[model samples]
Structure formats: C-alpha cells, structure tokens
Target: ELHLHTDHLNLTCSTFHDVHMIRWRLAIEEFGPTFHSVPGSSNVVADALSRLPITDEELEENPTVTMAAVEAAMSGEFTVDMRVIAAEQKNDKDIGESEEREIAGVLVLVHPKSKKILVPTRLRLRLVQNYHDLLLHPGAATMVITIGQVFYSRGIEPDERKLTDNYLACLKAKHPATRYGKLPPKSVEVCPWFEIADDLIGPYGRKRFRALTIIDTATRLIEILPATDATSMEAAYLMDRYWFARYPRPTRCIHDGGSEFKREFAELQDNYGVERVATMTRNHQANSVIERVHRVIVEKIRTKSINTQDEWANFLNDTMFAMRASNHSMLKVHRLSWHSDVTCWWALPTKQIGKRSINAR
Candidate 1:
C-alpha cells in the first residue's frame, strides 16, 4: 500500500507538471552524499541539519534572562524606608524628614520591589553616602549593584542603559547649562576661596527658592552658602559670612555674567582682592563644576520638598553636608576629608544650623 501511495503521489505531480526536476538540482544531492566525509565544522549543510529546532514550549518552560535584567528585578524587590531606618542607622534625629523621603524616592525608583528589604541604620548611612558621597551618581545598573552590595544579600543589577536613558530624559527640560558634556582636566586646585560661584533656583512650597553655590574647580567640592533672593547684596553677604570667614581670601572667583553676579558682586570681589572672572556671555560651561553642582542641589531640594512640609531652606545644611562629605569623581576624593574613614561626620557637622535659619527665612 505504501509503495502504491508513493507511486500515486509521483503520478499526481507528473500529471499536474507542478514538480519540475532540473539536472543541476542533482548536483546538490551529490554534495549531500559527501557531507559525512567532510569535517562537521566545515560541512555547512551538516551543521545546519545538526541543529534541532527549539520548541516554543521549551522556551516557555525556561525563560532566559540577562545579568542586567536580573539586577533590575532584584532592585525592585529590595527596598528600605529611610524614615524608619534612620534612627537605627544612628542618623541625626533631625536629618530632615523631607530629605529622607527624597532619598527613599530615589532608592525606590532604582529598586521597585524587594524580597527582604532591610532597614539598616548605620548601613543605610554608609550605602547612601558611598553611592552619592563616595562617587558621583552612577547609571541605574551600577547604582543598584553598588547600593545592593551593601544592603541586599542578593544581586541588584538594573538595566543600566535604560536607566541612563531615562535619567538623560529627565534633564531634557533643564536649562542649557545643565546639558551633558565632557569635563575638562583640572589645571589648578580650586582652594576654599578661589572657586566657581553661581546661583540655582528651585520650587519651595508656593514660592521660589534660590541657593548660592560655590564649588572647588579641582576637587569638585560643593558649598551651599544659603537660601536667599538671587540678588547681588545677598550673594555678597553670604559669601562674606559663610565663605570668607572660614576660608582664606580667594585669589579669584568665576561666575556667569548673570546680573546678580555683576554690579555690586563684582565690586565686592575686587574689594576683597578676589579677581572676578566671568565666563563668556551665556556660556555656562566655563563654570561647569558649579553648574553641575547646582543641578544636584535642585534635584535634592525637589526630592525632599515634594508633598512634604520641609522647605528647601531647612535642608540646605544637610544637603551641603551630603555634598561636601560625598566623593567627587574628578578629584577622586571627598571634599570634606582626605581620610578613607570619615564616620558619621554628616550627622551633625560644624556650624550646625537650625531647621529654619534667619538668612533662609
């Protein structure tokens, strides 16, 4: 019966003239005969034939995930609420509730869910500082892993490229000064006095808040003078009290040609024997260090202030401490200390200010 069926199929094809046999087609069949005699690696037909098709059922039974995906999933699984963890971490009782919430928000975005999220006290402080203070913010994957290494017992890798792309998207609406660029190599050390000076603006409750920022060009150290109106007199006074009082007179100061940095501010710098070097008009890159630091400050304020009673003014000291104690990427050192061990210094550093300072209010 099988032989008859085969003959019938051949008859059907021949009768319909649908199957045409070319003499050249036999050449392919001849090569097939020699496949086994050739090396498997070199035998293209043999190699192709050797591969068994993987069924959809097999794929469904075992899903393959990459290292980056695994880390991202883990980050979502392990989260710690800083409010509950702060006291145990020996953090200042008044570490700014808004700041804690802001930090929590940041950590949560990186880690959405957690299997066993630990609310480590001291460990939390270390992780937060090391991630932010020890180094500049990393991509989502590294940030997750770096924080996870200290807190989670498991891997916490996120999709680094995706996270980075999202972060860049956040900056899309920022001022031109906040755009990304390659940092220039430092030619000279920026001392306490001689540094880049600028002002950043952010939302505080219903009103707008402005901060005077000075950053060491060489070390990437940041100092937040105070929250005040972005006026020349306020800038000069804050610089005199918070800046010049502790640090030696700066050799020079670099700033954008903003009106607030002109007029009285320029005269004030000259009076103190500090040369006023302004960047080319509208060129923020000339003072890129401070410009970058300003973004950080604004983000920090935005994080802590949203839906919280804490105003940006209240958290300036804490924010400044975090920035100063945090590690700088370019200088490869902590602005506040050169020592590897600077423990709990951020809890309450020198010149501790009230939650509401007279200048800020």
Candidate 2:
C-alpha cells in the first residue's frame, strides 16, 4: 500500500526464481508500482536503527510525550501515544469504515471487517523479509517493535526464544569451530609473542594497497608496512629481514591463516628455528590483540583520507606512532616509552606525578 502511493519500491535482491518473478511482475502490474533494486549498503538507516538498543530511560518514559517530541523535531507534527494508537488499532471498528485514518499524524488504512492492518499481500512479504534481514538474523528484539510500526499494531508478536535458537543454529552451520591444541603465553614477558598480518585498503584512487601490520603482544609496539601485495614471499622476506634483525630468535610465531602464511611461509619459520602456530580460523577473539589494532588503523585511515586515499600509505607511520605512544591497559605502561634500564614497566600514577619533577614527553 505504501509502494502503491509511491512510484517505486526499492529492493535489495535482483534475481529470483521464475515462479517468484512472474508473481512479483503480476503484483506490480496490478498495484501500479515499479520495483527498483538497490545495494544492501544503501539501507544504512534501517540497519543502524534496527541494531540500536533501547535504554532503560526510554522504556520507562511515556510514549505520547517522547514520540510526539521526536516527531515534532523531525516533521513539525504532534503524535498520539503509541499505546493509545495500538489500543485503537485493536478495538476501533468505526475507524475501519473510513477509507483511511490518521494515527500519530500518519495515515493508515484499516481492514473493513476484521479491523486488522490493511497492507498489500506483495508488500507484506517484503516487509517481513527486510525486518528479518536487518534484525531477526541476529535474533534482536527490535523485530517486534518494527513489526508494530509497519503494521500499525502491537498485536503482531514473534516468539523471541524460537528466533534466537534458529539464528544460533544457522550461525553454527555457517562457521564450524576449529580445535586449539595449545595454551597461550603465561605472561607478557614471554618472547616470540607477536601477531603478524596484513589487510587490503580501497580502490579510492588508482588501485587498492595492502597494509602489513605487526604487533608485539608484550609491549604492544606496532609496525605498519604499506605494500602493494600480501604474497607468501613478501611475508617471508619481511620476517627474515626486518623482524629478525631487531628481535632475538623466538620459540614460537603466531600467524593468521592467510594464503601468504602457507606451506612456503612455514618453511621460512623452520629456517629461523621458530615453531609456527596458527590462530583459530575465522575467530577474532583468538587474535584479539591484532584485531583491535586493525580496527583502530582502519578508522584512522578512513578519517585521514578525506582528500585522497592514494596517500593513505603516507599516513600509516604517524597513525602507528600515535598508537604506540598510547597507554595499554594490559601492560600498565605506554607501549613505546619503556627503556632497557627500567626493571618495572608500571607507569607513574597521576597523584604520584604531581609530587615528582617528571618529563613524560
């Protein structure tokens, strides 16, 4: 019905079965509305809003006051309480006699006899699918609220426990777990405790570039190497040349399960007398140290690449320098501020700093 008033209904999927295509075409012809396909990324508003968690304050507030204020700010229109509107939707038979009626400043058509929400059958499926795609796959509770808003009633409720169970089943089927047969380092002082990896950056300019990031788990000292490719030879050469020259021979080296760290890379590790260890496949928590750093680096890249992403490689050094200078909660010290003479890496507290003549910079 919403699409009927509008010229077009935007869709995310382009292809469908022959039977579905025919049915959809016939529905559009009958309804006098066209369908336009759009990318998933374009549905940002629905995606973000669906994932937004409701606060305790929001739940306790009167819906009439809160919703009216929000609607007034957005559209200069007053709204009735959602509870009142819901009650009317459930029991108001007089409203169904009219072709359309306004609730909270929005016009909706009511069913003639049943007084249920009157939505076109074609749109009903699309509406449900969108809600599921954005909220239900994650088993979020927002689906219930969204259904009420679209259908103009709080009567449409789904079994949340069942939805969550189904979502978990699907998630497990898609990503099976891997076995971890070894234990982690006892403490940060342990040697050969590092995560070496690389990720791809955009096509914002001529071509996409690979960024090689290495981090020492103990010190949190980071090294960023921007390159053109992430091949096994490049990774091996980096370890042999840059890494080996600075640090002592390690007992173990942790590697992400990229093609760059495959058979030949394992041989390179053997040459250095380093036992190669791989992180659990597709598990971010297994390599959380590097994963956290990757997020920060990518965010910085996006922020600093306002003019052109061609020069993102140039900003890597400054970004990495800042990250290394920052304090780490785990280590209890600034990552790069440690000296060899210092036995303890614990940073001076703010209260202690005031009593000493310290030059932190």
Candidate 3:
C-alpha cells in the first residue's frame, strides 16, 4: 500500500461535496493509496513548493497567463469610467459649467474653489456608500466632511442624510435623529389661574436666596417671590403672600417633587382645595411651562445685578414686570394685558353691563 502524507485535511477525506474535489478524489483513489495527516511544520517540502516564487524569465515567457491572473484578481472590484462621468456632468444641470481637470490621465470635473474632484450624479450615491462602508458607517455630518475633504458633489449633504436615514444597519446601531415618543397631550384651561405651574429658581447670589416662581397657564402671568430658604414653610408662606392672596386659587397646581413642596406646602394646597400635581422624578418636561420661564428670569437677574450678585433679590420686581409686559409667544398678547381682562371682570362689584375698565398695571 502506498502512503501519502500531507498537511491538507480536505485531501485526506474520501467523501467530497465539490465537483472538482470529488473528481480529484476518484482519480487518486484508483491508485489505492492510504492518506495520512501531518502537521504543516512537518510538511516543509510541500509548503515550500506552494510558496515558490516565479522567475523573471518564466514571467516573460508567460505574459498571457500573468495578464489573466491580474484580471481575475480585479474581477470583483468596482471601476468608474472617467469618460462616462465627464459626459454625464455636461448633461447635469446642477453641475452647470464647472471647470474640468485631467487627474491621473483621466478627465474629470472639479469644484472651482476647492479644486477637489467632483463626483457625477450617477455615481454620487455609490461613492457615498463605499466611503461610508470603508469608514465603518459614520454619522451623516462626519461622512459629509470626510468625503468633502477629497471629493465633492452638489447637494452631497442632503444625499448623505437620505442614504443614512434608510440604512438598516445604521438604524439598528444609532439612536434616532428625532425625539421618539408622541407629544404629551396639551392641558386646556377655560379661565385665567384655573391651572398654574410653580417652581423654585435658586440658591443664587451670595445671599443664597431662592425664589418661588408661579405662572398662570391660561394667561401666562408670572409671579416671583424671593425668600431666604427653600423650606416647605417658606414656600407655603411665599405662595400665600405673593400668589394665593393675589389671584384666584388654581384648581390644579403643577410643581416638581422638591423637598420644599412637601408637608406644609402640600397642606397649603389642601387647605385651598387646590390639587397638587408633582412631576415625575428627574423628568422636568412634566412641569415645562414654569421651567421655561426659569431661564428668562435667571437671565434678567444676571443682566441687572452684574456687579453685586448678593443684590439679585432686588431685581425680582423688575424681572417680573419685564416678563409680564413682554408678548407671550403662545397667547399672542402681553401677559399683563391678558391678565387685566380677568382682573377687570373681578373688579366689577355687580354683574351689570358697564364701560370696559381693562388696565395694564
């Protein structure tokens, strides 16, 4: 019996799935040789023969074979025809009379200012996909900048955005560009002060004074009261003096779940028959109405008390006045003006019809 030792495991197997391997096995089996497995290190002669380099004389003698091997290696690669790209650029209205340049023996259109090669309309998407895959799928802005560094195309940014938006792999890996959930239902209030939102602004300035900010959801009227601390007692006292006493008690009072809004402050709401709606933990959007106003108030205080930060409480009245006078984006009227309409109705002692008495105080 003839024994053949080799490193190739597939050659040792008598059963073959491939057509060529089966034919090879049948021809070798006719000789009735026993196949033996050996380690690659032990098969030095076969390994050396497989890795043998061709001589210059042998390559010169077999030019056709060398050309066929090169063609086989490049069969799977994508190649752009510069002539076709140049022809398409002339027809593309968006490209509109761009300068042409000969790059690497190929005529191509180029951006006038940047002097980078301009990709044609037909290949723009394909070019973006290739670069995106090469870069392991980056964000749209990154891909746009990277591609723009070497190559350019008109409306590339939008094209890249569209391509990435539809890519399934990217969709799975990246967070959505827009907010996910549906918008929260809007709270509807028929009368001014029916629903109000309240929040505490600070611990700002050297005095560490905190302010209770209350806003009427219907009229957009804002009321601010400065205090030494943010305790429940102080919050309740400030609200009673500045908010509860000044306006009708809001049916629903929305606020954050701060320590200052518990115990005494909650009891104050119960006493007035006002429903206290505390926002979810760490979720400020539940009380966004008053939260948005916090930014404006802080900005105003910063501007007014630039030198002496301890005097921030002194600017509370001025900040409230400015906010009241400014046009409300949602209401489309001054907050004070909208509130004056309700105040006038309350002023009239009798329900008898009389001359209008709206004042912007």
Candidate 4:
C-alpha cells in the first residue's frame, strides 16, 4: 500500500465541500494511498525547496524568462541616462548655445521660447521608438506632431519616416503611399445644380432612422433629410420637399442601384424632367462625390450623438451647417461661398462670360 502525508489538517476529513478538494481526493484515491495528517514542522524540506533562489542557468532554460526577454527587446525600453545625454550634448556641434533646463529631476536642453526638450543625437532613435510604441504607432506626420509637443530634434521627420518604414508591424498594417494609376481629369461644370448625386446614409440609432443625402457636384453644397425608412416613396417625398422646393431642378441625378431609388423615385424624377442615372452595380465610384460627403456627415453625427445616439436626427442641421462652412478640399473654397459665387457668376451678363468669369476657359 502507498502512503501520503500532508500538513493540511482538512485533508484527513472525509467530507470535502470544495469542488477542487473533492476532485483531488478522487484523483488521489486512484493511487489507493492512505492519507495522513502531518505536523507543519515536518514539511521543512519541501518549504525550503520552494523558497530556494533560481540560478542563472535555470532562468535561461525557463520558457517564461525567454518570452519576457523577447518582449523587452521588442518594446525597446527607455534606457537613455540623463548624465550620458548631458555629456554627449557638449560634443554635439549642432546643439549650439541652447539653454539647458532641469525638467522633472533630469537635465535636458530646452528651446528658449517653445520650452521643448532638445533630444541628444544618440538617444533620438530610442526616444522615437518609445514614443511610437506608446502612441500605438501613428503615421509619420502624426508621430512628428506628437514628438514636437514635448521634444525637439532637427531632421526628426525623416528619422520618424525611416523608422516607420522599416518597422515590420507598421509595414504589415499601413497602406502603400504609391498611387496605382493616374486619376481621371476632373469634369468642369459651369453651373451649380447641373448635375447632382444622392444616397441614403443610415439605419442608425435606436429608431433605425436614415437620412437622404443630396449634393450639388459643382458647388459641393449638401442637403440631408431624415426619414423613418429607406422606401422609394420616402426618397421621392424628401427630394420633392427639401431639394426641388428650394434650389433649381438638377438635369441629372446620380444614385446607387438600391430599390429605394426605383418605382416612385424614378416616376418622380421622370415627371420633373430630371434624368435618373443609376450607378453601375457595386461601383460606388460612379457617385463618388456624394459618397465622400456621406463619410463626413456620418462621422459628425456619430461624434455629436455620443451618449444620445437615438437622437441623431437632432444633429442633422448642425452637421449640414458645419459641412457648408468648412472648406472644400478640391474647390479650395467654402461650400456656401462656392454656391454664392457660382450663382452670382451665372447671374452676370453673358457678354462678360469670356472676359471676367472666374472659371472662364
């Protein structure tokens, strides 16, 4: 017969309330050993062995230690000593006569007005790596801006770009900067409302509300109307009530192949003499103008709706005003300003078109 001895006084009890203890008892029972309740003083050898220090060789062979070492190397911990930087700064000719300031108990060179630290040449790479990792590996421009907030280094932009370019994780996650093909030349529209694009934005919030998004391609002016559903009748109603009621009727209306733009929507466009141009299936690029605006509008609504997402409709007008007041990337002018300029330009005498028009060819 086998024998077992443990200092745990509860082990000798027949009844075990703990599931783990019961499982251990069942497992030990398989060996057919007699359990003995031993004095705590008799467990000296096992206790001493548990308290023994791990040797270097044992640590080297440990999988946990090896993994920790790998992690430490990858993380590139901050190891630059202030004394070392202070010593090296004296030799760095580029540092010039910059003022040295003791910040947070560490000696660092600081710019007079900006008060930003001037990092030593040898420490810049490690500093950049730590900042890059801490900020979750932002893009080069973002990294420069973040570093500039607290630290100043000459040619830091190129250094940051170089590091990010070589970083394997960043390489796998980031998109290539190269453009695949030449972008098609922009089409010049002389007047606003000549061509327009429309699309539906949501099914967002608790109400499952959606917004009908319409844009004037020439002026980049947008109109957003909230609806309870994405039905053809609702789309037509919003177009009639919001768009056609305010501005001049558009010649062509570009939209996706969704069923919401069919039936009643097609009939409404037909009656109004507006040609309905359905985008090619699965090709959103056909209506890229409105598609781009949709992203901006959704982002704004999402930001404003935060804890009150169910009331996204309440922020629609604010979103519209912000979009109209903001500068258009392509036109390089505010949407409202562009709309006003286009309207006034067309209002001028036809004789002045060739002489004084802003976009005269």
| TM-score, cand. 3 vs. native | 0.43
Full-model lDDT for every candidate: 0.47, 0.48, 0.66, 0.67
Model 1 spans > 4 angstroms off: 1-179, 182-194, 200-205, 306-310, 339-361
lDDT by residue for model 4 (1-361), tens? 4566778889877677995675566445533467798898998876788799989888557624110111112343455566667777887778888887997677767888898887778778877787665444455766676667677888677888998788765554333441121123554545556888899877764456688999887667789888778899999999998999999898999998898999999999999999988975434345667866764554344233222434455466656765665444455445676556645645555343333224432
Ranking by TM-score: 1, 4, 3, 2
Model 2 clashing residue pairs (backbone): none
lDDT of 2 by residue, 196-283 (tens): 4432223233345566676765456667766556677776766676667775455667666877787666788888787777865444
TM-score for every candidate vs. truth? 0.46, 0.41, 0.43, 0.45
| Number of backbone-clashing residue pairs for each candidate, in the order shown | 13, 0, 0, 0
Better of 2 and 3 by lDDT: 3
> Which one is best on lDDT?
4
lDDT of 1 by residue, 1-361 (tens): 0111111223322123232232222222221222123333555664575597989888768854211111111121223355555445345342222312235443311123352244333444344433532233333434554445334423223333344445432233223222243345654432323455655444344344567777655335566755557777777777777767766566768887777777777778888888888775444446666766765664444333233224344466667765665444443334565323434233332332212111210
Worst 10 residues of 3 by lDDT: 65-74
